[model samples]
Target: MNHSVDIVLPWVDEKEPGWRQRRIEYDQGKEIESTNIRFQCWDNLHLWFRSIEKCMPWINRIFLITCGHVPDFLNLDNPKLRFVRHDEYIPKEYLPTFNSNTIEMNIHRIKDLSENFILFSDDVFPLLPIEEEYYFKDDMVGDEAVENIISTGSFTKGLHEQRYAQVNNMFIINKYFKKREVQKKDWNKWYCEDYGDRLDRTRACVYWYDFPGFYDPHMANAMKKSTLARLWELEPDALDAGSRNKFRGASDVTQYLIRYWQICTGDFVPRRTQGKVFFPTIDTYKDVVDAINNKAYQMISFNENCTPDEFEIMKRDINASLEKLFPERSSFEK
Candidate 1:
């Protein structure tokens, strides 16, 4: 299948005064005021772009979902690369109260557009090019490990309404099917006072129990354009317009939909793999380089330990495969 994957990242500029200081303060144990919160979201933006460059011969469109202030240095004229800003889709009235900008943008895009694409976060750095098989691998890690993590963490039982639903941050959705199913619901009243309390309770329970291990509650996931359009049809006002300007507080809305799906349909398949090879977070450039080297070593070790001759053959084959996959990247000077 010729899949169109849209890699999305929300970013903000650092030129604003005290931005660096704010990040440092927040990273430390200091009690910085929430009003003055500053995150270097662009750092991850650059990393994501670099990874895309390294794994080239781009398969689909790359969408940098932002709220206008994208740095000029990162600008490029690639036909496949697009920048979708929040103000374009969100209504001005509800922007202030919205907490999560990232989720809202995604929902807005899904609601307004009708394409099947993958959504990704800037924080996640792919060390090596991932083939289709790597994404849909068998023998996946299950809910058991996630359950163990929740049990050990600060989670309480019965706080949430549902069980057996786990959250994995990275996932792929067949948007065409998802959007078709969403049109039948009434989203305006979904979060009303009567339903809000119950939903909150359920979410709290899921967060405490099913978040870390089973799901990547923090990372991004993939879905189809049709699914988003249906969500928009159900609740054009579902996202708070004000929160779209920044990256924080958006996942809550995303989680709301995720939870709704869990209740409506009992399908929660893990999308990305979680193991030594796939690190969930990357804090620095060194981290990115290390991860790639590690994966290469692992591939080599697997072959060498079993058959030394095969080890050399595998290296040559892998290099050839990469070259074929990314011809432009040969000049990347790695």
Candidate 2:
């Protein structure tokens, strides 16, 4: 029983030359404005790899997907790591993409990617010593904590439009499974039972939830390459909807589709852990401190929804915490 699993991280260097101009040009004529490009890298690649080496040294090959923006400090000579640019696997038509969704949709196409792999972002790091079983048990993926999918009420109210895409993707995914009718009913019922009093029943909109599973946070996400390939074969339209967008859009499918598809198809094994995995919204210094103090959290992530000033503050705090947590340089560092 081979339990080997690999790691894939989709990263970007926001300050890459011409990135701003390219993004501006790409934005011309799109129906929706995409904020996915607003993320800050903070040059944390070395720190993130160091965390992996410190906590999960047994991980197989690490694939860093980027737009040819390899970190200057990265040890390209490291045998266990590979740098994959968008031109390597993603179709040429979708090149020069700032859309994370487009990049995520094509990661499974990486050559020789392990059948079982864990997908994470550079902003996410393992908080404590983690075992292979933390992400995969008995060769099946599932262990990272999951949250309930938001249904009804303000899924589309935000100005940023990321959540709007999330909800729309969920609807498309359900429709593909032919579960739209029943899932819609279940969602309406759940919404009523949970928030019946707060809402105006007369004006409530019917929203669908991915009931069996919800989009987990930006922490490490486990995935099976074959399952993702199957998703592409089964729902090319959905995949295309996500891929064709130059940026994140309202109809774009999320990376969660891979996780949810695995759950829906019975390909996953629920995590055996007893306690919750802490992936806090990085709103303040306290949140980062709380995660640091709590060794129980196996993984953590810093989402990029804050103001530019706040982002700078959070990055300094997070990088400092990471430096303290993983002091020794990893072999992946130059």
Q: Estimate each model's TM-score.
A: 0.50, 0.80
- lDDT per residue for candidate 2 within 1-334, as digits (tens), equals 4467899988877787677678778778562435542555676789889889888888988998888877888988998998898999999887778788889888888998899898887767777888787678787776422335454454343334576666755665565554444434334432333333333331233243334335355567788998788878877886886688787776677778787666555555554332233333354555765675565477776555565666677677777777877889899988
Q: Where's the lowest-lDDT run of ten residues in candidate 1? A: 139-148
What do the candidate models score in CA lDDT, each in turn? 0.37, 0.69
- Number of colliding residue pairs in each model: 18, 0
- Give the per-residue Cα lDDT of candidate 2 at 296: 47
Q: How many backbone clashes does candidate 2 have?
A: 0
Best by TM-score: 2
